[model samples]
Target: MRTKEAGAAMDSEFHVQCPYCGEELDIYLEPDVQGTLIQDCEVCCNPWKVEVWWDGDERSVAVSRGDGSE
Candidate 1:
């Protein structure tokens, strides 16, 4: 994983597979922003709930099925 500064926010990319469609995708994340967001797969049109966080010096992301529920 690598990070770059994009405007006022720090931009990073995370590689993950869609849970529903198993499509590989790259998710752009901001380390300064910590929260869960809904992202749709470009290949399958399935939604995924992505959680972004920091683990010490590295950034981490987790994905789950996005059914519009918290």
Candidate 2:
């Protein structure tokens, strides 16, 4: 994971493909934050519901369409 500093916050970035547009984009996740959020794709401008969490020593991320449904 690549670490970037923004202001006082440090973020770890990972690549995820947009389900709608199939475009890969970088997702910056804060180590202190863990939850689901809606984010827009930079390539297609489509919204995605992203879930981030830490499993033991590894981080896991799940992405889905932003329609508020599973």
Q: What is the alpha-carbon lDDT for the whole of candidate 2? A: 0.76
For 1-70, candidate 2 gives per-residue lDDT tens digits of: 5554343253367678888888888888776667888988888878899888878755677778997654
User: Considering only N, C-alpha and C atoms within 3 Å, which residue pairs clash in candidate 1?
Assistant: none
After superposition, the stretches of candidate 2 with alpha carbons farther than 4 Å from their true spots are: 1-11, 68-70
Give the number of colliding residue pairs in candidate 1: 0
Query: Which residue pairs show backbone clashes in model 2?
Result: none
Per-candidate local distance difference test: 0.76, 0.76
Clash count for candidate 2 is 0
Question: How many residue pairs clash per model?
Answer: 0, 0
